[model samples]
Each structure stands twice: as structure tokens, then as C-alpha cells.
Target: MTSVVTAGGVSVTMRGPVVDEAEAVLDRLVTDGVPASLMAKNAQLWGPEAVEEASRRLGWLDLPETSRPLLPELAALVERVRADGLDRVVLAGMGGSSLAPEVITRTAGAELTVLDTTDPQQVASVVADRLERTVVVVSSKSGGTIETDSHRRVFEQAFRDAGITGEDLARRFVVVTDPGSPLEKTAREAGYTVVLADPDVGGRYSALTAFGLVPSALAGVDVARLLDEAAALVPALHQPYDNPGLALGAALGASALGGRDKLVIADHGSGITGFGDWAEQLIAESTGKEGKGILPVVVEGPDAPGFAEAEDVRRVLLGARPEDSGLGVSGPLGAQFLLWEYATAVAGRVLGINPFDQPNVQESKDNTAALLRGAAEGEAPTVVAGEPALVVGAVEVHAPAELLRGATDLTGVLEAVVAAIPEHGYLAVMAYLDRFADAGAERLRPLLAQATERLRKTPAAVTFGWGPRFLHSTGQYHKGGPRNGVFLQITGESAQDVPVPGKPYTLRSLQLAQAFGDLRALRSRGRPAVRLHLRDRAAGVEQLLSALA
Candidate 1:
């Protein structure tokens, strides 16, 4: 742990064993061409105030009082959902409102889905079908999210179409927002029950509040379990080396001085999907200024999988650490963030960019909009197909015997295929090999060095989480970056179809499988790539890695 004086004259220490010598590493990073201005900006973002605010906000005291009057009422609502035979809960909102529920669902492995996009088909499907059986949790701190309102309008129509009207909407729909926000007013006027989000708490930080809790509870997740997990982190905050979150913020802030442009947050599970959005808002809104910001890139692996091969793309920062005894203190979500904070700071300092900004994010949006505009007029983006370039390596085919045995089921079969790949010792990717995170650069650092040593040039290392979300955030980069990576695409076929009870949506397993296929199709064109299909998915992780060899 290193101690530094904040600009406020207060001494704050990041509590963790340093990955490398901080100042020496920082010096070496700058010598490599990191801008000094970025360093100065990060120094300010990680100064006393920012760190203090983060600690407090992430700590126990920042959460609502445990005994608030609404606790039991909230609990009752959740219990009711479970008893009513609902199988999935859908949340509608974008950014902060969307990310919190995502984290909670992931941490608890809840059967809740969050939709933040304005896709009409997606909205129509969920509202037209699921809303009748599954509850809808609409979260908007400002109560004026155009997307949220749009979803609500669609949901209301669905309710009416189902012969469920008026007061019944209050039972099936819930709203989380500040008092008098347009959402609040709409909810009250529309006869929907309201759960107030803390006015003082910003949207990005309201996951632990009503924004995250209501949906989490409805999904049968234990919200209190999450709080207890967070509370357990209190003692660690005061001791510098013991605190993961603070250490992360500091190291990442310090890394921004070094020139690391990407902080990839790699994870799996639908519940955690919102994490990317949360990180997106947090880093983009907080650390973007003074011309230096670290792009918070998030990627996921084989629950969804694809790796990018773009030269202009930046480093990969793996967020998960090996599970430790201390982790028992916090819930999985808390542990995920605590570990991520440390990695984020480390990547920021090494990269010399503030981890709080969205640098390359705009390029994708602009490009996509332009492509859409052209397409609207019956003009499609031009694609010039060249020779098939086998980039990553040849796609290995298991013996007929092995493939047949593996084909009994998707999970197991996929595991066997991946386990065949020899583990690359020097490059440490996320536990799941195929996904990328904002912090993934740290994992790829050694591989990068090795590649640079052999090829005399660096390849862009890009990552995306779940297949659908990546198509939104980094699709443009993958399509446009100078193709130079061995894209590693990983996905699994379903073993048993877990039907959505009475709903026509066969099972989430199929939807996810199809999404992965769509992602693969996007990457296979003009690039040398290999796709491995795992029909049996229950295979163990070690077995999967062995197959990858």
C-alpha cells in the first residue's frame, strides 16, 4: 500500500499490495509517451475528495436505514411476485437506473432482465408477453427518462390489452424515483405504487437503494444479503492495504497518467450485464475532462464470448481475481466491484488516462448513426470482402469419438472443446478466456509484450461482454479497427431447455445461443476466425480449458 498526500492536506492510503512500484511504473509509462496532462487530471480525480466520496458511497452508511418503514412492504411485494408464479422480472430504464438492477440480479443470480435500449421489437416482445405474468420495475431517478417512459407507455398498453387495467397496473408495475420527478408524477397519476430513490444519492450510486432493491427482491434475491455483504466491507475501508475499492480507484487514477486507454470489466451472468452500463456512466461522467479520460470498456466471456482483433483498440483489464477467504465477507457483486476497483486504478495509472471518461465511445455512436442513416435511404455500408485470413489459429476439430461423446449436451460439449486449448501462461485473461473487460489490458500485458517482441507491432485487444450489448458498445470498433487480432469466439449450445413456464419464449438458453451466433457472424467476415460450438455445456472449467488446448 502506498500513502500519498491528497490536495486537501489529508493523508489517504490505498490498501493493497502494489502490483509494481507506483512511481517507478508511472515514470516508465510516461517515458513510453503517456501525456503528462492526463496524469495531472487523474491525480485530481483520485485526490482526497473523490476517494472519500467513493468510500462513503460504497460503504454501509451510504445505504438506507435497515429498518425503514418500506422494508417490509418491499419484502412483501417481492414475496408476492414469487408466490404469484412469475418466473422473470423485467426492468426498464437506461444508464444508472438500468445498471443497478443488473448488478443485483447478477449478484443474486436472479431471474430478472433489464432492457435499456430503445429497440421496438425487444420492448414489444417483453411488454406484450412477459408483463402480464412478470412484474415490471421501472427505475428513473429523474422520473423523466424518455426510454423509461416509452417502455412504461408500452407496458400500460399491454396491461390494457390483457384486460388488466387501472388499479391492477399498480400491482404489476413499480416505480423507483425521486419525489415529483416526472416518473413519480406519472406513476402516481397512473395509479402505480412508488418506491422513492434517495434524492441525495446520484443515479449511478443508487443500486443499493430502491433502484436496485425492488427488482432484486421481486426476483427472490435477498436484498438484505447484499446489504450485509456491503456492511462487512466497512472495517476494510479504514485500513489502506485491506481496502479493495479505494486501492482500485487510486491505482486506476494513477494509471491514467501512464496512457492505458482501456479498462475492460469482464464478467458473466445476465444479472451483471448492467455493470457495463454502470461502469460506462460512472467512468464516462466522472472522469471525462481536461482532455484525459480512461475508456471503461467491458467485455464478457462464454456465457457469452468474443475477442476483438483491432490495432487501434487499447489494452484488456481483467476484473475478477481468484476467489479468496476474504471474499466470503462480501457478496459476489460486492467482491466483483471491490476487486474491480483495484484493477481499474492499476490500469488507469499504467495507461495514463483518467478511468472516468468515455474517449472512443462517441466514435461508435456516430459511425452507427451514419450507417443507419444511409441504410434508411436503402443504402447499406459497403463491405469489400478480401481473402479469408485465418487469424487466431485454425479451428481445432476433436476426434469423432470425442465430439460424439461431447455432443450429448451443449454445456459439457463446449467445456470439452475449450479444455483442449493449452493455457497461455504469460497472458492472463479473465477466468473465462473469451470475454474482454476494461481492465483486460492487465491480462493481455504479457501477451502484448510477447507479440510486440515477435512482430514488432502491437495488435488491438478488444473485448465485449454478453453478445447483444457488445453489438451496441464496440461493434463499430470491431468492424472498423485495422484487423490484426486472432478473434477468440466462445459460446455454448443448450443442454436442457428451461421453458419460461407458460410463455412462448422456449428458454433463455436458446435466446443466448442465438445471440452468440449473431455476434460470430459479425466477426467472421474478412477476418480469419475459428468458431467452436459446445453442445454439452455442463463440462467443468478445467475440462473446458483442456479442450481449448
Candidate 2:
């Protein structure tokens, strides 16, 4: 792990399976970009002593009696779903509301297919297929979550198409939302059961609450065990020096305030990817504002994309403090973890914003709606296949040492990637672009800076599609981007594969590539313009990537 002390006097350590690389990346970031103002803000929000004080008072791992009431409710709901004979559960929401449970499920080793995408075909497929054996759980704190509502409509229509409308729709579905929101009314009107999301609990913070519990119950995950695990950390989580979560949270927040605004959560194995995604949505939605935000990044496994050479870009996963270094307990049970959330919550309170209400978050829904509308009207276009595969030109590939030298400039590196893989119609590199490390900064800085320079040098719209969880969120954007998004889709052969039971999709190369192909079609002029391929892993797996770059 490499550690950097922020101007606020908070030290952040970026830990990952690849300690040497991660350390180097952190050192580079601390030296190159963190600003004083941000550090100061972080200092106010996550100072060590303050964090310690907060932990001691909150009893790091202690759950208030008020919060305790939720466990039974959640457990009961699980029994209800199971008793009702539902085998699948679809969580209908975006960002924080959706990510955390999926994370816990994967981490705890539970099997439940989570649908967080808005693609019509994907949505229809999940519903039509899963509805027979599963129960769709529509979750949103605000009943008005446009995306959730859209999903509800899809579900309703699916039921209607199956001639299972009216009471049947209600029986097949349940809702986890605000008690008095429009969603509750809709769920009730449609005849489905409802579970209220506490008004006091924000989406990100609600994970320990029903946000995680409800889905957990449906999946037959041991909610009690997970909670007990969380409960054990209560005291330590609240103590600054002793609480790993608080320590981690403060350090990470301080780092962001210091100018390391991009966070990358690299999962060495199965559980971490979902956790990374969960953390990404939490920080992105909470801390992103007022001329500042921490961009959270998630890398599922070693073979996952985003690993570029040393000179190009490197990935880092922010983790809990020293003492909390055990597998499940390590990442979430430290002072840094608590402090980061506290700092984010405090910042929101200072901003007079309801961190709980993600209002403009609905813009994504509007975009999707507009795209679908356009597609239907023939004004918005459908992704077509591109021409026969084109052969890419070869480029001189540099050694990893040389690559590290150019690590700070991502645009040049990406251009090299494009040149190497020129034959592929679309090229998306999985290089680390998280803001938490110098490597990430270096990785993305060049591309953005180059784009700026290019715009200055010329007037073209330097088009780029950059996102951490773009697989779900920006597929529409990439597939829908002006037929110009070079889709450099990345996938890796998983060390472990979980087949969808009886379903033909085996989570293997064919299905994974098929998913990539769905994204590729967006670049088609009715031709095969998209290229899909795989790597052994994110690190040494650049064998194919280097061949193209």
C-alpha cells in the first residue's frame, strides 16, 4: 500500500492486491494534483481527532434501538417472498439504491440475478424469464424514481402481455419504497405488497437497513449473520484510532479533498466488484458537488479491464484502516470508512441539500426515454451491425517501463491504443482512471487534457465515453452516442463462473461476448462496427490489448 498525507493532515493509503503498483500510483497522485482548498474542506469534514470523537460517541458498531426495529421487518419480508414461492427478485432503481444489495449478495456468496439496466431487451428478458420463478422487488426511497417507475411499467406490461395483469401483477410483485410516495400508491393499486423505506435513512446509508436486507432475505442470504458481522464492528467502527471504518472513511475523504477525487475499488476476487460498485454510487452521489466530487471506480477481478501499463494507467482500491484488514471485515469496518460517510453527510448538511433525495438523478431516465422515443419514431436510431471486420494497423509497442513514463498522459496512450487496435471499429480501454491515485489522474489526465488541446488545436467535439460502471449506465450512451463512440469493450475470462442454473447463459465467453455485442451494435450503421475480445486478467492480461495498441 502507498500512503499520501493530505494537506488537511489526513493520511490515505491505497491498498490493493498489487501493492507495489498501487503504492506508486498513490505517490504520483499526491505529488501531482491534490489541491490545498479541497484538503482544507476534507480536514474540516474528516479530521482524525474529530473522526475519533464521532466514533467514540456513535459506538462504531452499535446499532441504535431505532435501527434495530428494521431487522425483523426485513427478515419477515424475506420469508414472505419465499413463502410466496418467488425465486427471483428484480431491484428496480439506479445508483445507490441498486448497487449495495447486489454487492452484499455477491460478497456473501448468494445467487440472485440483479437487473440494474434500462435496456428494453435486457429488461424484458429478465422479467419474462425470471417472473415465472421470481418476485420483482421495486425499490426506491422516492416513489418518483423515474427509472424505477419505468421498470414498473415494463413489469406491468410484461404481466399484461402474459395475460397475468390486475391482481396477478400485484401478487407477482412487491415494493421497497417510501411509505407515502407515489410508488407505494402504485404498488398498492397494482395489488402488490409494499415495504416502506425509512424517510430518515438515505439511500447509501440504508444498506445496513432494508436497502440490503430486503433483497438479502429474498435471496435466502443470512441477514442475521451479515448484521451480526456488522454489529461486531459497532464499537470499533465508532472509535477513531480503533475503528477501521472511520479511519478509512476520513483518510479517503481527506485524499479526495486533497485533490484525489477519483476513487477506484479494485476487486481481486468475486465479492469486491459489487462492493466497489456500491461504494462508487455512494461517493459519486454524495460527495460530487460544489465544484468538487469524488469519482468512484470499480474493477471486479484481475481479468477485468482498466489495467494499462505503468506509463499508461494503473488501478487502486481504497480500503479500510490497518487493524480491519481481514477479508469481509477489512474493507467496511474502519475509521476511514465511517469518517468518509460522515464527511459526505456533513458536507450535504452544509450544502442544505437532501442527500437522500437524488432529484436530478432522473435525467438519465429522461435520456433513455428520449432515446427510446426517438428510436420508435425513427428520429432516434437503432444500433446496426457494422461492415465485415476491418484489419487494424500495427504500432510499435513500448516496454512497461516506457509505458509508465507516459502514464500521466492518457490521451496519447489511448491514441496509441486506437492506432494498435485501429481495425476494431470501437475501442474501450480499461485503464485506471479513478481520481484517488496519481496513476488514475495520469491515466485520464492525458485523455481529457489531450481532448482540450485537440479542441484548441481544432474544433471537433473530442468525443469520449468514460465511466466506472458504464456496462450498465452508458451502454445507452455508447450505443446511442452519435454512431461515433469507439466501443473498446473489455472482458476477461473469469476464474469462477456462476451459470444461471437452467438458463443457457453460462456466464462464459460466449454469453459475455454476446453482451458485448449488444453494446457493439450501437456503433453499427447496420454493419459489424463493434469488436469484442477478452483478456486473461486486467494486469498481465494486456496481451491482446498490447497487440491492438
Candidate 3:
């Protein structure tokens, strides 16, 4: 491993010629004072085009120091909750607002149940937990995330159903949102504990902000130490050379520039659980737009399938140190978070795109909203044009007849998706199933990724994300990034659909709407995409594996 920067007990390293190729670009960025400018929140470093948005999105740069004051508040809140015999912390959030906290709590070995999906089974799984011991943290940057809102409604109803009311019910919720957001307003009126995030910070970059810290601190992670860890890296970030942030940014920018846009991230003992999932959102959402982007393929580990060397793929190690070839980012989670946020901003400048803006993420949400509106109007959701192309076992595969190419079964559908992939292209498997009940579905990513490579005798990458959750992360890349990707959407029928409290639609309906909405978005772009609806999730998964094998 080539060690690039070591700061705050964190080391940035990478092996192979990827960093070597980035050396020249690193020099250019240094000569242009990109690192120092980014630290200063110059905003224009991303060019005049990004200044307006970047100006308001750079608050994360100062979060290390600025967010220190939140520690006592978070600690006090946690104390109160625990004292009240509420030991479970379930976070109701999506994407940027949820991913970081999920990682943080998990790494700390804290029991923080994250509700980041519209899957009814996933919601049901959480709701089935002991409600009397739970305090749900509802987080949303815009205060309008449908999944988060729906989660709050469900949890509130669950609490009320258990005879909790008024202040007791209010105390069961802690809301983290932007100041003056509708959520903050409603949370205050509802007597829920309200913590306002920095208004200038965007959701993805709010790792050090209240969005990430409150839930973590409440769930028993040392928030103060996270800030301190991040603070130690601040000095190095201001320097152009020997900067961990620059080293990472160079690795990312160079890989994307050298036609290696699929970043294979694996945690070979990173001690930090689920960091890649969080980074998946930050990198994919920030850079995957404007037709040029880096797609992060987060693998289970070094042993995970899809780790096979590919010309268009770059390996990234997120362990204690670099044990294999790839860009290695290892440090305390707090510092690592800051490092990546800085690098993403720097890489945005390198790639000539605005890192702060999520132009396409809203489209899928809008589509889901429209579908939900129709559902309320008693109009059938028209996400699919017609019937399934073929049904194999308990799974029904839906695709345009033209794209199916006369495929008769599930294996043919797999072949069709593989056939659609261009040189250096990828396949994305999106599951709109309960990550809890249908957890085994994740195995399909590696299985399919390896299968594609074997079938074509060429390196291919496959990415998996739970639906609606990915809708906020890689969903951006699938719709806005390189069109070289083929999509396979997997959704399951919830045996018992969970209603969204007062909302018109149920959680199962919301999940389908999100899946079909994104499917429509992909097909509209003329992307070779298909939807696999599992009439029986367990049986369908088994059948899918058999076919893939």
C-alpha cells in the first residue's frame, strides 16, 4: 500500500498505477490552491457555475468545530431517553440523512434501528419491535422526504396505539431537520425534541452536522470524539500536498478520468461497519450527474464477488490499512467522513461538475409522488406498460417485449440484461423488498455480477441497493450517470401491507410506486431495464439463485 497521508490516526493510501496517474492532476490541483480554497469554502473553486449552490452547501467544512456544542445536548437527550426506559433508537430517515448515522451507530455497536425504506415488511419489522422502549429520530434535510414522513406517521401511530399520548408520545420522537423546515415546525408544535441542522449544509455532506451526530450520540457513540477526530484532519486539509483529502480526491478524479468509473469498495476489516453504504450515497449522488460520474460498487468484502479486476474498475479498501491494491481510506469514522466530503468537493472541481446539487434525485421522488396522488384518486399506477414478459417459478419478470428479445424465462431475462451491458458497463440490481425479511436478496448482487463476467468473459460490475433507499443514492447515478448500465429491479409482495397512518397509500404501495417509478425513469431513457416482481420472496430468491447458478 502506498501511504499518501496520515492524520488523526487515519491513513490515506492506494496501490497500483491509479494514484501514479493522478499525480499530475494532484499537482495541478495543488498549484491552483484547490485544497486551501476548499477549506476556506471559496465556493468558486468548483467554477463560477457552482458558486451559487456551493456557497450554501459548504457548512460541513466547519462542522468539526462548529458542531461541538451539540454534544452536551445530544448526551442530555440520550440520558433522558434511557432514564425514561426507552433504550431503542430507530431513525426514520432516507439517504444522506440516514446513511451516516446508520454507519456510526453500527460501528459503535449501538442498537440504532434505521428506517430508510418504504418496504412494508421492513416497516413492519421495526414496528413489531417493542414500541415502549423506542424513541424514533425523524430526520430530513428538506423536511419533505416522503419515506421519513411516512415513518414518523407510522411510529407516532404505533406509540399512540400503545396508549402513549401528548407529551409522552412527543417524547418518543426526536426530530433532526433544517431550521424553519416544515418538519421542524410540526415537530415543535407536536412537542417533539427538535434539533436543527446547519441550513447551509446539504444532506450528503451533513455527516458531521446534526443530521449524523444527534442520532449517533443518542445511540451511545461518542459524538465529541467524532468531532475531535475530524478536527485533527483539519490542519492537513488546508495544505495542498500530503493531504488525506487530496490523496483521496486524486484517486477518485484520476480513476474517473482514466475511464475507471466503477469504484469497487470493500471493507477488509475497516472496524467500521457499513461505511461503504454511507460512502455509496456520498460519492454516487455527488458525482453521478451531468452524464459523467463515478459509480461506487460497494462489495461485502475482499472475498465478495465483483472484486475481480476490471479495466473500468478501481478497488478501494476501507479497512485498518491497505491490505490490497486500491485507494485505501482508513481512519476513525469521523475523520474519514470529513476526508471524503472534502475529496468529493475537490473532485467535483476536477470533473467540472457541481458536487452539491442533486438534479436527478428529485425526479424519482416526483414520480413516486405523482403515483401516490393517482393512488389516492383511485387511479391505477401505470408504472408498467403491460403484463410480464415471462414468469419463472414465483418471480415475474417485466420488460418491453422488444427488449426481452423473445426471452422465455428468468434465465433469459438475466441473459438479456447481461447482453445489454456495453464494454465497461454495469448491471444494477435494485431490491424493493424488506431489507429485514428479504435480507438474503443482497446476495444476488455478487451472484449476478460474477455471472455476467463469466457469461461474457469480460469484467463487469453489479451494484445492489434496497429500493427507495437507493432512490436517494445510486438511483441518481442510474438515471443521470453513464447510460452504459442495465437495471434489474426486484420487488416483493408484502403478505401484510403496512399502512402509512393517515396517508392515503400503504407502505407496500409506496414501495411499488418507487420501484416502478424508477423503472419508468430508466426505460424512458431507453435504458435496457426490467422489473422482477416476486410473488413469493423466499421462493423467488431461491429460484433466482438457481437460475443464476
Give the count of colliding residue pairs in each prediction. 83, 64, 0
Q: How do all the candidates rank in terms of TM-score, highest first? A: 3, 2, 1
Better of 2 and 3 by lDDT: 3
How many times do residue backbones clash in model 1? 83
Q: Which lDDT value does model 3 have at 300? A: 84
TM-score of each: 0.54, 0.57, 0.97
**RMSD, every candidate, angstroms:** 11.8, 12.5, 1.4
- TM-score, predicted candidate 1 vs. hidden true structure: 0.54
> 1-549 in candidate 3: lDDT tens per residue?
265677667788877687687888899998998887787889888878888999999989999999988888887898899898988889999988899999898898988899998888778889988888998999999998888999999888888888999888989999999988999999999999999899999988988999999888888888898899999989999887778898889879988998989999999777899999999999999999989899999998887889866889888888655555677778888899998998888788888889999888777778788888989998766444367778888988888777787888877878878878889899998988888778888888888887886788786999999988998899888888988988888878778888888888998778878887888788778888888889899999888888788
Over the full model, what C-alpha lDDT does candidate 1 score relative to the true structure?
0.46
Which one wins by TM-score: 1 or 3? Answer: 3
Best candidate according to lDDT: 3
Off by over 4 Å in 2: 1-67, 163-166, 269-273, 300-549
